[model samples]
Target: MITLLSVYVDLALGVVLAFLLLSLLVSGVNEAFVRLLAIRSKFLWAFLRDTLDGSDAQGRSWLPAGVRDVFAALPFARDPRPPHSDQPAPAEAATVPAQETKAQDAVTNLLYQRVREIDHPTRGRTSIANLPPGRFAGAVLEMAAAEEGGVDGLLAKLKSMGSPLHGHLKGVWESAQRDLDRFRQGVESWFDGEMHRLSMLYKRYVKWVLAALGLVVTLLFTMDGLEYGKTLLRDNAFRASVTAVTEAGPDAYDELRARCERSDPVPCITETLSQPALVKVFDHAIVSVSVPAEGDPAVHWNGAAWWDRLTTPSHWPGYLLTYVALMFGAPFWWDVLRRITGIRSRHHG
Candidate 1:
């Protein structure tokens, strides 16, 4: 009974340690993919168009009707394909024209200028992922109002345009008894509230994209979790070595994450496997009976060889297992491994 229990415990430790390292490597790749594509900028562009002009990502329809317009837009940016869009896309999708024209209107002009002001180095000025409401309000009041003739002139223009924003701003101005600072503060608060809604929407989209990326990565690597675990289970030397590493604590996970932080998917994976701690676990004398290529290793990863294995029906479960394990994420497994190690330490103590 004691020997069997010892074997089971080591098997569990080896499997959990392997998964924790795999999740970190996969997560780094996912982040790199998101950065490379600038998906956040795409999401933001969708948000502006849906909320603004109800046409473009203009501040018009959104600002005029206030929070109701933002609430109405919801997650409209997910499927940005035209012919199906609630509102038709202009010639250039999400391109806020720099030059002001009668066709663009006041709100779009403001949005275009704001995009220029907040353009980040990483995503570039053309497509932006983030903009603060405070800066947005300041732009409207400073640039938009300066040209119009200060607060009074801008207010007079607002009264004539018949915009939804007109009523809200006027109420704030009147309630503040025409105090400039108070009015600006009120407008800033309004923009801040609405911007928060867009942030939440962006995050929800990111979660779904991560899931899709996770599946793609599993397929590309031909990562079969179930099969790998079975191989290690049968190897007493490997199981014992891995259990020792796992029992030693989280040093294995921390070291891998640091090494692979800047690496792409393939390198990230190789770095984890080549880690001194784990490499030592794999450095055992070969004991197999069959010697097809005298010195050729039993397990070698290649796109051609793995792709064939991936197509086999028996290997499908392994792919599914790897995908599910990666989705749990590195942080989740790290915590689980720590608690597990703690339990073992206490038991031995």
Candidate 2:
């Protein structure tokens, strides 16, 4: 029993330590990805700009005029000039009109608004000047954004931070140290929730393990006690007391002596002793018999029987406790698994 208990204790300790290490590992990996994403974001934006300039007309207009004209006649040509730059050169420009200036301003503002829309701190969009003309431009822009290192950059930044990706990683990293501190607090809160759940599960496992061990120990001790009690009843003093009272007339004495020496002596003795006159004689003889001064007393027939010894009130308390544990144990484990794994099962019943 002691050896089993020690083994269980060691296993429980190892399990607890392993869980702690695993949690730390998960947290560290998540933060590292966040930081990597930040660095990747910077380089990704630069690459996208370069790629657009090499392929698109609005971007390629910086090239020689001959090259621009050659590419302009293509089926899917792009205008090298800025949108609305066709008004005129400053010297030949017409006088300002209020309505026209307002309209131009609106167009310029719209362009700026579009730029802002795609400029996420973690995943900025690729330039639209290189995009093919179509109603699918918006979708193409998003796809290009994802392809041009946007998703990779975001993932890298998360890796670099050595933390999990949350909605607040971007603005918090961009801001001052104080903002970063606040972000850490939020991450800490998430970690705390995870830790709490793990602690609860560990406690529950310990309880069930202890309960099983306790049951085994109880059964072992009970069986051992019963065996020792049987040994005590077979002593010389108990056998002598049974033999003396059964000896009587010459015929009876010879028969009883023969039965006493047989290999299965107890059954033959018990049958002869059941006679009313023989039982009275044996009872009186058993009560008078005594062991030596240093030895324990011989076994005797008492009103209290073996069944009386076997029955105990203490068992009721243990059984009640086990029942309560069983009632709650399943639900408690189910709730813990649901909270930790974020899995829900739907059942109409």
Candidate 3:
């Protein structure tokens, strides 16, 4: 029988290994396909345009003709169109007035800077999600005030569009003329209050994206949580070997996180007996859990149909459990690993 401490240690180690595998898988997918998909980036661009761009006489966006082009010019900008579409060129679609070029440049730059600042408050040094609500609101207001006509310029730009909120905004702008700080504070308060909705929207989109990626990753790696757990519980020698490999380094988790942040996969894989070592444990753990290699049993070619391998009554549940665990991300599992390891050390000492 397995000792209680052994169960905790095994479970914790399994979580750690799962996290590393999922982390690598997420990074790999992002590197390979995020630019190609551009789902989030396109959504971000459209959301910014709709939120910030003013409407013209024809009820179309008046926020300069080359605004999209300008955005496309930025680093990491994603064009929503296919690489070789038969559609009309952007220049053929929208024409800008010569006089409006300067204004367009100003507005585009302001919007770009503001959105970038609000979305990535650490000046692109950190994850966009790390930007707090206060900093995000402050960045938006600061950028608005920094525009051509200052706060009034921003209010005028928004008012020019004649949005439904124009009347209320006009009153706010009028009051802001008298007390800008108070206006900013009120706007910040409102923005903060609505941030939960924004966060939920972001999470909803990202959750689906990650779920799709997680499914691909789970199948690609053949991760089987139930089988892996069973293997660890039954194999003392394998468990001790992997645990010794992982626990060799004191700063292993921190180092792994730092490297992951930098996207330095080389150091993560080969440098330590941590990331790759953890992955090896996972591989060995699931070795006995087999999936279909070839084809339909109906055709007499195989052990099981591919669909049966994926969705049969006995198989998919474990794979799905593995994918859900991957969705928890590395940091969460890393913390669990630390806590369980600490507990073991205390108990043994």
- Against the true structure, candidate 2 has what lDDT? 0.35
Error of 1 at 78 (Å): 14
Which portions of model 3 show Cα errors greater than 4 Å? 1-4, 27-44, 54-110, 113-158, 163-168, 174-177, 187-197, 237-313, 343-349
lDDT by residue for model 1 (316-348), tens: 898898789878888888888987778433465
Off by over 4 Å in 2: 1-178, 223-349
Error of 2 at 125 (Å): 45
Residue range with the least summed lDDT across 10 consecutive positions in model 2: 88-97
Candidate 2 on 1-349: residue-level lDDT in tens?
Answer: 9745654444333323322332333334433632443322322222222212222324342222342232233212422222222122222212211232221322222222334333333223222222112212232223224333443443343344322231333433344243434544543454345445534543454354334443432332221222222333333234445655565434445444665776566676665444322122223221233343468866565334323422455444543433333333444545544555567988898
User: Which candidate comes out best when scored by lDDT?
Assistant: 1
lDDT of 1: 0.55
User: What is the number of backbone collisions in each predicted candidate, taken in the order shown?
Assistant: 5, 24, 0
After TM-score superposition, what is the CA distance of residue 193 in candidate 3 from its true location, in Å?
Answer: 5.5
lDDT tens per residue, model 3, 96-185: 111332223333334344334234222222123233446545555665555576666655654554333335445655766647677666
User: What lDDT score belongs to each candidate, Candidate 1 first?
Assistant: 0.55, 0.35, 0.49
TM-score of 3: 0.50
Q: How close is candidate 2 to the true structure, as a TM-score?
A: 0.20
Highest TM-score: give the candidate number.
1
Question: What are the clashing pairs of model 3?
Answer: none
